[model samples]
Target: MASSVTILFLLLSIISMGGALASSKPSGSSDPLIGEVCSTQSHLVCTNYDDVQATSIAADQVATAASMRDASIQTINDLQEDFFLESSLVEGRKIAIHNNLNDPAPSRPFVPSSAVSSLPELTTYNALDIMSYFGVARDSSMATAIVTAAYLCGGAALPGEAKSCAASTKALAAFVASELGNNVSIYATKGAPTTYSTSTSHVKAPVTILKVAKGSVEEGRKIVVCHHLAFPSALYYCHAVTGTKVIQATLKTEGRLRAAYIKAMAVCHLNTELWLSRHPAFKALNIARGDEACHFLVENDLVFTRALQTSG
Candidate 1:
């Protein structure tokens, strides 16, 4: 795995090239930034239960990371703290990016109408040059967080899929409304959105997951999965998918009472055919052709579906 500095420069080179570093395609290969980051944190990817659970922890979480989504969900408060609240910067930056969709990697988040001030412009010759330009320490968490967000936002869209990065709750609402209409509800993993820990190996498998006795299990239609991003402020990389099914299940692992994890264990069953044959879900879940590969939503991910039955 390349160091964060290494990943940072990779993003810089892509920015300098000013081409499509990534497509809406989910394959790691589709996006260079995603590919490098995924390679660094292979354990966190959407692999099988054993692989995901057994994987070690990373120093920091990647935004829109191609990670395996399972495990101890974090608390809502933990999720809420990252937002910028009413800051106009969030909406301003997002709108700017949406307007200039073709600029695969934007250095400056310029907005003429925005009341916010101009932000620093990012540029570089290679991955390392940018790190040196910013004086970002090799161990700096920002090395990945900022660059990851940059690539995720600037990357291309998948066929028939619409994506956006919302830096605030208001911006998110607008994006969701634009994509799924107003009559929608968002279901996220209940409790705190937690990451798997070296200490909490107790949550690992060797336990059976009973029927999805809770949450919504509506027929396929339009569904949105918003992944929380790591940024200076709260940001989410959200994408809309069609013909996907969502559910919130509670598991009975090893006869222990359900942990106070996610309020609703939202799950998504991606259409297998539409996905690449090598998608982590396919290999991890042993999915057969023409079948769906279902997996738990990441702790930080939120699901937006038509308000079928609210998971209160």
Candidate 2:
């Protein structure tokens, strides 16, 4: 007979497999690339913008603009992959918890945030409007990502020489990740740490420690568990000490998971910003504080949280 943990993992795997299969199916109605690019109706404009940007890059005076455009496109694809992978793991965790606790599962299927429901007609977009779509703040990491993408995509002229968009985007992403106190190398390796370090070197403040009680050793432990489980390629177990209260223990575990989910999603948002900035269409527009974009990101995070809670 399979152990409970084995059964739990199997059930979770099936859910993940289903989502993957659904994503893999080819759509007959829409341009597949456009479908991949826009995850929601709100993001539809971004796809049109990307097309115009690509065309402009092809026609730019810089000799390397074409290559830069291709690189930018590839970066967007990479960001999409990162988003999907992170989302899958989070969804998988939700499934695992639900099954393990014998809770009712989510009624609806896991619809990806970026999944295209209908094909949108290509429309004209002003540079300002297109820039507004990204929802970037002038000094935010999103803004930096866009600038970096522009330089790489040959949308902006580099003073001395040109570099490949892929290389530039990668370097810029790493730099931004580091500046934001994220684990820069982790993005490339795409794996969770084997052992949780007591060191706070890479822990971003406010996100990791906010609302957590000071001098509460257990709270820190819970945060570490959440971080370990939520972001990485695999989940890690933290042993509960003997005789912990059942209700209290459950609440603690749930809190940790929630915190971890937020942190992981925030990272994905950061990555998305990097790719969003690089798209050719809005290269010339100035980035300002975008309340809508920021709200969308927060709303997406909340939706994920609610889905997990309701289903679990």
Candidate 3:
């Protein structure tokens, strides 16, 4: 079970960190998006027409920057939602979790048969639908929200906005790290450790996989018990421990099997800026923040890595 989860996390991390799944076309020269110079005059007060015009232009630039930031956020949310849906296959693959597994016959009961002579019908859901129904999308959604927010801050029009965004992103990153059971926070705003090495190393936290094993086939009926295990970065050594409140809730509801699978996925090479560009709501607002964010950070060569199933 631990192995299964490791595989799942590794796979998901790949997708989450994978290059932007959605891309928009390049901006035409007719409408320039970047390097649009604004007047830099520092007037004591807007006493004259030129001064007022310059100040107004600066205000527009700031407003434009804000709009773009919002767009990037929307894109990240979409990606996160998509990631969970894709990961469901590995999360809910167990025989016990599938009603069809119980009976060899293709037809099984999903909705009860109205007539005695009628056969009990079965319903087969695709990978995404099954995951959605079980609410396995929570983690992906959360991760996306954090990543997108960070990207937005970095792309803010003014340098001040960028620094603030970076700081904010770092904070959200800390929050996500906590949720993922990692004590280390990459974002410094939360008072998390500032470094990750020996001399500079501030903290190290375990990434864990929760496993449940049903009774052996030889046994009359399979009774599955799942516990949590922590592993180093590579996920090779999973050490068992007591379940957290979240884990316990999942177990009681028989949802842990899928929840764990989803939680265990890790993402790699995620481009913070690119994700912000593909957000849907941003399109509705007539703003192209996602594209701008990518432009700002692609040069820095940013990449994100984490655990999960490779196939998801």
Candidate 4:
């Protein structure tokens, strides 16, 4: 029984040792089929995993580029609006030039009227002079600010579209001019009513009397046109577009005061439109045609032929 037990123990020990040796051998070296399968599996896993990682990285790069493109487009639109607003002021000045050239009030010298003891001479209160005094440049920083706001609001557009804006502003200015004429005429022809006092500040400017024609003045129309001589200067007229009011110690003709108020309001509204129109992004996102955006304010009064007739 002792010999049988010892032999069994030796046989078991040999089998355990052999199994341990087989387990310790390198996998690739043990059998060609096993090695090939393991190698192929490892290669497949590496290739598949690496491809996925590459695809994810490429996608991230493409997304980043697209985001940058959108931001750049927005920036360009903002700039176009800025240009439009600043240019509008220039257009206003041009309109004034047209009106002034057609009118003869600036060329004539005047003597105070003896018949109307309460009033100054017609030449002294010329409308052209008043306009000259109030005309402001459109190239100012304030003008630029107005345009920028307009651009953001989608009110302004490229040069092609600027014509309409110019036309609208010019028409409004003409309307204001007509209104000023009436107000000045009333003050000149009908001495201030008992309700009003003619303080120095309220004293009528001589320039306000300049009329379109002799008949036009007597009929109660103060025909005056003004243009800004300075290319980039602001007139600080009776109005500013930003809702800031300027007080004046002099040149306080009722017409001028009223005109200032009107100008201030107009500037605020129009400036916003001008900048928005000229924005680069505005053009890119243009829902409307370019020509429709910018309109020219041609001064019908400024035509040489019209001036000749009116001056006579």
Candidate 5:
């Protein structure tokens, strides 16, 4: 019985060894099936379980690469769209400016006696003269004066018209106060209005006025001085100044007219500056186009962003 048991154990051991040899892969041997499955240069050994895992990993990598490529393309497309939109806005502003420059001057209504009466007597001063008197440079102060004059006169007074210098200076002071607040100093004459005060720090003006005889030739032919304190620049009697009349006439509501006039004057003043004229964005815009472009930009906030992008 013992000998029979020993023979059975030996037979079981030999069967187990044969099964292990059949399942194990030889170091130097390549399977025809594995070569066919792994046809690429990777030379990966393929088995039923390992082949599925390898294929899954490869597919995941391919999907990841494709997704990355697609995302990159989408990002590029978005950037291109943004660039085109900005470029179109810039072009539109340029065209608007050009058209405004070419348009004929608008007719202006006669200055009312009330407006004329409120004006104090002023010396005949051009843009440069006003800048000199104010002790400001030719760049921004001249523009501000022109805009201020237009606003105070309600767009009726011209540079050559008989207007009050004191009144215009007051208008300039008010303008500075409104826009810049306490950035400047203003000295008031005793018992006079704040507007009649002279500015000490930034704006300088003569205390004494050249008295003209009631019947003198200078009485009715008084010096016309209009300033835009916003621009701080001087302007001659031109369409930009006169165009404020168009705003007053076209708009039915007083509030709307005032708002439109302010916006238009701002553009006009900006156009007068040498830096703005040479600005890449405003290179195509000139003084002639100031009125229309200003209105257009004010109405379209998006376009205004493009116009003033480089202003800062």
Candidate 6:
């Protein structure tokens, strides 16, 4: 199993950016989707986003760096074992993220994914070479998505972590069954985070806990945050850490004219020790590396929570 970070390097602007199996009932086709998914983006505001930082927030889910999508990559990870260059990877991510936030964006504007699924990868990416890893054409709309998926697949799993990349809902169902079980419900949101006036300065997509989901809630329940990966095709990276919480809520963001309603989810990873101190999320959330961190599941990110058992 490959760690999410292993894929982050590849997933971040082509270098940037889950699960299981068996004895499992698949989440039916009619299975309610967490929220909504958009293949193309109208805007992208996220910058150097990843779970590595405490304040990682998605301005838009599907938006990403244009360079990541169009760049041709090399197979550096395959040939070089000593990849995961912390400095280089971080720099590349910053550069790509800046590109994403700047004007004259990609043909398809995207709201950058503040999908704080996991920390950035240790290695860096060169692009395209690994596209072969996911078995997709370079010219395909899903080219960037496929390569990112491949990076996740090829990542090396770390201790106390179970990881995978599901290309379809069925695949995601299988991964969930293996990791969690049928006794769970999914949650998500497609709305913007509630805005507030800050004393110092206005932050980008701050994490706001509007309310709790209408359902049975419990403490210490196992949870999996299935972040909608940036794939042209439907691909999801469902992630669960040792200490995580999933809260489903009916949230209404402070719209410009009127309030808009949405079913939103907030995922909090209690274990922040795994991330690097320099990750931007930490600063965004106003916390240190060792402190607990929380972020909204933006861009159609889903949260699978253990459901209360009922007698038939």
**Model 5 spans with C-alpha error above 4 angstroms:** 1-93, 96-160, 167-225, 229-244, 247-263, 266-312
lDDT of 5 at 74: 21
Error of 4 at 277 (Å): 3.5
Residue-wise lDDT of candidate 2 within 129-213, one digit each (tens)?
2123333443343333333344324333222222222111122222222222222111001111212232212221221111111
Worst 10 residues of 2 by lDDT: 243-252
Model 4 lDDT per residue over 98-168, tens place: 12111111111111122112221112122122122223223333223222222222323232221111111
RMSD, one per candidate, in order: 20.1, 20.4, 27.7, 42.8, 41.8, 16.5
Best-first order by lDDT:
1, 6, 5, 2, 4, 3
Model 6: CA > 4 A from native: 1-142, 190-216
Q: Which lDDT values do the candidates have, in the order given?
A: 0.39, 0.21, 0.20, 0.20, 0.21, 0.38
> Cα miss at 168, model 5 (Å)?
6.9
Off by over 4 Å in 2: 1-79, 85-266, 270-312
For residue 171, model 5's alpha carbon misses the true position, in angstroms, by 6.5
TM-score for each candidate, following the candidate numbering? 0.51, 0.18, 0.18, 0.14, 0.15, 0.50
Candidate 3 local lDDT, residue 265: 19
Residue 127, model 3, lDDT: 19
Better of 1 and 5 by lDDT: 1
What does candidate 5's lDDT look like per residue over 239-283, in tens digits? 112211011001111212221111111111222222223222233
Top of the candidates by lDDT: 1
Cα lDDT for residue 209, model 6?
27
In each prediction, how many residue pairs overlap at the backbone (N, C-alpha, C within less than 3 A)? 20, 2, 27, 34, 29, 37
